[model samples]
Target: MRTDPTQPRLRPARRGRFAPSPTGDLHPGSLLAAFGSWLLARHDGAEWWVRVEDLDPPREQPGAIERQLRTLEAFGLVSDGPILRQSSRDTAYREALDRLLGSGAAFECWCSRSDLAATGGLHHACVSGPQAGRAPAVRLRIPCGESVAFDDAIQGRVAQDVGTEVGDVVLRRADGFWAYQLAVVVDDAAQAITDVVRGADLLDSTPRQILLQRALGLPTPSYAHLPLIVDAQGRKLSKSTDAVPIDDANPLPALRFAWRALGQDPAALESCTDLAGTLAAAREAFSPACIPSESVALHNTGVAIAS
Candidate 1:
């Protein structure tokens, strides 16, 4: 199996994307990610796109995508291009899996969650199995000693040993849906995204995506992981934590707050009439270095001023 070298490489053009799964409403944490990605694309003079990761049908809320889009619109984070739906990209994902298999970069494993759990999470037993051709989830073969390292604009240098840390990650799940890591790498490469800006919660996942890019012979994109928004309990804000959804009825205040949370000085731009202008101002003055590395609690003011 040979790796395809014809896949596009990252060039000077500014292309970025914000992909969100339709599992729930856009909470404050979600807004921070959207704003961060939007600002990164704007600052780099790049085109921004959105991809609906509705691949996992069971977990998707019937109207969650529409609600999420409205929330983003309310916050003035409009993306270019018709939104790409991962559910419609089954053939593309299958082709990518086939390519991985042909290149000997991926293999089929029949290990179930319970089976893998018995051996302490890592799929060591599956890797040593003698069975072949079982209807199994496909896993990428992480080459030994191969290191995935990338320079993150916010987090600085990041390096991961794929074989030991990530093990053989799933490409196609036994449940029939494609894994997030595989779909993301494929979509970003297809869209020619050169930069990825999102929340710090995904910091660990970056290495896995980098591994996929290497195996698929695709160009890796630049990354900037912003500080994560957390609740009073120190857990990352999400629907489960009852984090307030973006207040669509009055979005300006929340947008202002999100900018400040990302370390942009929003005080001077208080007079900005609309969300778009506020975001524009933020991009003009956006500095990744300004964002504090630590997570701060949001106050009644919606701002994440240092604690």
Candidate 2:
């Protein structure tokens, strides 16, 4: 199932997506990503989509998907198309993996964490031989000195040496789940997504994903990594105790906080009293240049509803 060399990758319509892993509830930090992505799509008159990254069943919480969708609905951030869940996308991932494997761009590695510990956890070449019952993790075979560079829409120019900085990346884990790097690339191309807007926390993972896109011959989407919302100690809100789920019972307060965090003027949403109006006004005022490159502190953002 190698990528047809005859068909060249073409840029599609502007499509952006907010992909959230259902490991926990949607906090303000998560809302910032959701809101920012939604606003960007609306501002560009593009299609916005929501995909649940539910590939890891063990880390996912029960009933989290339903709650996450409900929270998005409460905030008026509905997807332009039907929601896509990674759990149901196994066949597509397999096909993409097969293409990479057939092309010699990917390989099965028998290395475990301990096997690569001495080499700083980078799988240059598999050190451990295949075990009797253990399955080998599939990883993209990054050639020596291979590098990837892209101009981030918001973060500006970015570059990384794949072989040295990231080593070979896993496409399917030893635990029998499709890795995020592979699943995301496959899904984005399948959905014809042209733009990717998410938190800066994932900025490092971009190069790895871009490599996968090239390997699969899929069109790489424009990426904009938004600043992450951190806690008092400057920890990402999602990793801190302050990552409490924002109250959907009153969505405006949370929306205002996210809007302001995105560097949008509070005055833009100040006059709007409801979610619909606020979103409309915010969309008109949204500007990618206004987004700060620095991480935002949670406490620094005032959560009080605009009077």
Best-fitting candidate, measured by lDDT?
2
Pull out the clashing pairs in model 2: none
Candidate 2's displacement at residue 8, Å, is 22
What are the Cα lDDT values of the candidates?
A: 0.79, 0.90
Instruction: Please give, for residues 189-244, the per-residue lDDT of candidate 1 as tens digits.
Output: 98888888877888888998888898899998889888877766777887345476
lDDT of 2 by residue, 195-256 (tens): 99999999999998998898898988999999999989999999999888988788998999
Q: Relative to the unseen true structure, what is the C-alpha lDDT of residue 214 in candidate 1, on a scale of 0 to 100?
A: 85
Clashing pairs in 1: 1-102
Measured by TM-score, the strongest candidate is: 2
TM-score of each: 0.88, 0.94
Clashes of 1: 1
RMSD of each: 5.6, 4.6
